[model samples]
Target: MASPVLLCVGLSHREVPIAVREQVAVSADDLPEKLRRLKAIPGVREAFLVSTCNRLEIFSVADSRTVADDLLREVGPAGAPHAVVRSDDDALTHLFRVAASLDSMVVGEAQILGQIKDAHETAKLHGAAGAYFARLMAKAQSAAKRVRTETQIARGAVSVASVAVQLARKVLGNLAGRTVLLVGAGEMAQLAARELHQSSASELLVANRSSARAEEIAREVAGVAVNLAELPALLERADVVLCSTGAREPVVTHEMMVRALKARRYRPAFLIDLALPRNVEPSVNELENVYVYDMDDLERVAAGNRELREQEVARAEEIVREELAALRKADRERSAVPVLARLREHAHGVAKSEVERTLAQLAALDEKQKKAVQAMASAIVNKLLHGPTSRLREEQGGPLAEAAAELFGLAEGPGADPVANPVANPPEGEAADVLPISGRK
Candidate 1:
């Protein structure tokens, strides 16, 4: 029997705060690099990385827990003690819940599902994802679409982006004549740009290391594009700065921002640093007339969204529970394959031994008579074993499967004889070997 191809070991908003998640969230552009590092681990076979402001997770299929450990190690300080792990059916349930935004700070937020899709695609392009992961993600995505369409989950309260925009409206009263400067061309920045544009902001500037990408996003939003070299100058002129670049280090350091603040004569600047590892420096918050809001600060805004959608959240949770139960049931069924194989081998071996014994006892009989006796014994053996065989087959995929397999000596070997084929039987009473993420058994 093959090992389960479902495993998830990583942290998120619930387990760790934004401070830790920011360090680990693989940026969209460099996600392939992170995926490569994860796959290079010994046990990992197929892998996908889903990274968002709310969570950073690695979904994979592996032979042992070591693969998950290796991923955490490779992610360095970013994945440390904060990263949580799950395996088999639990991992599948986690992915489904994540896609449905049931695992989000604000439940039913739709942005995460799209981020997961993008992450899966990025992994696919790099050969990090295989057939199993692709199928799993497809199923999860399908489930998310179903929940969104079938229920009120996505009707009244839609997305984190929209919620952020709503908060901005409440804060500044009006966006007219305000200048919004987007620090990166990433998805979060783009979403913010869309919101700002829709609110009829007077001007927009997109600054990025890749001027072409900046220009690309800028054109879409009817904004101007600037190089990273020009951000210092642009920062002084903008009223709102949404920073979400891919730099490992802080792109908007406190000192540099202080200089920009001085240039603007300490005027109030609404800064939303939406990057993980945070694009803006934490110290920048101390500056007067500079209101800096990162993901952590957004929790207050998320809480507001949560309170608004309290009634709808119950429905989403119910849907997630139903889906998770079905997935767990399916997993238990797959886990029973080894026991069924073992039972079949044991029955065949006993029948063979009985035939040999009866043949020796009937040596004095004629050849025809001996053959008749052997055939009769064979039929009787088969009939006697029929009930157990049927039961094993029928119970292969239910809740009782694992306990039942352990109770029978049926889970003993790879072949008919346990002594002769010890390797086939998993270490006495141990579970069968599962396939690792490395694609080897």
Candidate 2:
């Protein structure tokens, strides 16, 4: 009966440098291994990790603060300054905010929702998700959808691709004559290619596993289609490579790119990898005269969307606050369940013992009379406990109820049960910063 407590530790693009985030980036392929390592820690009943270019986060359910600390230590930098540690309500609220894009660099971009869903599924596939985390993620998803539907938060032209193109223009002086090599041909890649094309990139080349699909996208975008085999050669020719393939393995490995670099004789190339599994290898980032960026690096470009999304900030905040209050109320109501259950158990124990003692003392009575006496005792017990039971159910989180619980030994003391009455009497020391969950019930 260990109380379930959630822990969230994360580093985002806003907080850390791209180099740091990339170093700590848990690729989708490595998630299961990371989760296994996390669950092996002391008191960690369950664990999950969600890592994208914009954010890298670990969510876990544990019985002790030490477990959460271990999770942070494992996921965070040895001396990282930017990582945020959240527990309890704060963890829940942060997750909902992230899912809703309120915590994203681009406030209402739809990409984070898909990323969150993918992460959640990854956790489930690895057996890291249990009842508590599953319930929480479901609520977070629903809350995000509600926020999008009920508010104007998602309205307008906002996306990571547009932002990236805008940022590229800022860096490259002009995008008009740039040669853009489009890799992967996925939704994000298509979007980036479209944005670059619209921005007047002089030449566009689409290279993907499926030549036909690449051709289709290229034809539609008025670009040239090249076979995936030509990627290395194409790498030498393009000024910018926008890669967003679905391959779990890196399509552009460091060795492959090293040859391409040698072939091109060290020309500067901007490589943008937008795949979740990461189409480009991490080591390719080390290539001199090459600028490598992933989804996490896009945060710089996406940051501008924050200003546009600010127009709907008030409405979104109101929705979040209102939902948070309702969730808190429900959580408060649930806290009463344990107390009432304890009271019932105490009353039943007292009645059973007293009845047994009375029956022993009334040995001279006939069997029929004993049965009648037993019924009478049961009735008296029920009548005596009815008022207290009703009062206990109605007096949730009140001083009277807490006092009653203390006297009855219903509470296991501070930090022993996180889900008990956490918001009421938060634990001292390490558990003090735990926040309330602000998700929909």
Candidate 3:
């Protein structure tokens, strides 16, 4: 679809805040609806969206270079700062890195591969992804698989939940006899529950606004379900708090925690706020004997995890670069394909017409004579095409190529313009950082 150019416009953990990222994130349940809207946008011939909590990425192909802005505009993430837009080769490279998990905040995480696959499948199911994206996604997945298979990129603390649990152990020394309170029942909270169970935390308490939802997660982790109203009491007794609620505002504020601490006589509590907008208040960290860890705090642990996996990262990068080079070379080589096909088709057509005419005029000829004439005609066609075919292919996208097409009338054929540039940068956007580089070429 479109120019066969790959374009990716996205805001990631690199620059965008959690607040803005959440606004554009498309979840698994919301993917199909979002994909339909993305396809309906003008200038976008093919499209798919990958919106994880950490990022909101739009991948598309279009005729004009300005499509990136149109894409972001269509997605309604306008005025969001630090969006990176790439086209063709760079865009593909970015995708490859993302699939390989090299672009993740926690560089060797394994969950991103599954997420990317889900996006690819969603696009295909909705008919938004065509031959180009299909092939590209497949190749990207293959490379990611290879990276994981050949390197140790996914060795430690692969998910945010796991990292949060690991850090809790460091602060508490041992989780075996500790009471771990989970303030929400989201995926992250469930994962934390599982981690706590594995760490042999003595008592686990799950508190949610919906008692049924809390009960469900509690059953899964063999923990007890407590009502949301019991949060203050649970907070007083709990040694560790993992909060991951979907609430828009802070659930555990400074004022609330101050009351909880008074009940505990100011005993130390370790808190991990995994919610995007943050469930725990930032000011709560100032409380004596209370330690607060947000996503950004967990990020520091992820940075350390990345450091430990540096060797694996290097290997993964090399593999990604290798795959990228092959893709680029293949793209460049395909430019000559259309012209060669047109040349062959034209020659075959002429040879068939002449052979039919000759056979009709020489009706007196025997069966053997007709066969012999057919063989000669085939040979003539082959000989006639050999020289010009070789020359035109070698002169792809130049004056000589244009001249050859005009001389042979192959210019009228659908495949004549075989070597058009797949990417172009439009000058409509003044923000060079956010605009696609295709327009610059």
Instruction: Compare the candidates by lDDT and give the number of the best one.
Output: 3
Name the regions of candidate 2 deviating beyond 4 angstroms.
1-4, 76-81, 166-180, 184-187, 195-204, 208-224, 227-241, 244-301, 366-376, 395-404, 411-441
| Stretches of candidate 3 exceeding 4 Å from the true structure | 1-4, 27-32, 74-79, 327-339, 350-377, 384-441
Error of 1 at 295 (Å): 1.6
Writing each residue's lDDT as its tens digit, candidate 2 over 107-201 gives 78788889988887877877877766776677778778888998787875567777667656655658888899998866777887888988889
- Cα lDDT tens digits for candidate 3, 271-306: 988776678988999999889988667777888888
Instruction: Judge candidate 2 against the unseen true structure and give its global Cα lDDT, from 0 to 1.
Output: 0.74
The digit string of per-residue lDDT tens for model 1 on 1-441 reads 334334576777776778878767666667777888877776677788887788777888776655666766654575566666665545666788899877776667678888888888888889988776676677778778777776776664346566666666766669998888988866766887788878988888888888898888888878898888877888889888888877788888888889999999987887888887788888898988787888767776777777777677777767776765555445444555656666556666787788788788767888888778778876876787677667756765343444555675544454222221111212232332232333332
TM-score quality measure for candidate 2: 0.74
| C-alpha lDDT of residue 2 in model 1 | 34
Q: In candidate 2, residue 6 scores what lDDT?
A: 67
Output the better candidate (1/2) by TM-score: 1
Better of 2 and 3 by TM-score: 3
- Scored against the true structure, residue 424 in model 3 reaches a CA lDDT of 23
lDDT, candidates in the order shown: 0.71, 0.74, 0.76
Q: Please give the range of 10 consecutive residues that has the lowest summed lDDT in model 1.
A: 416-425
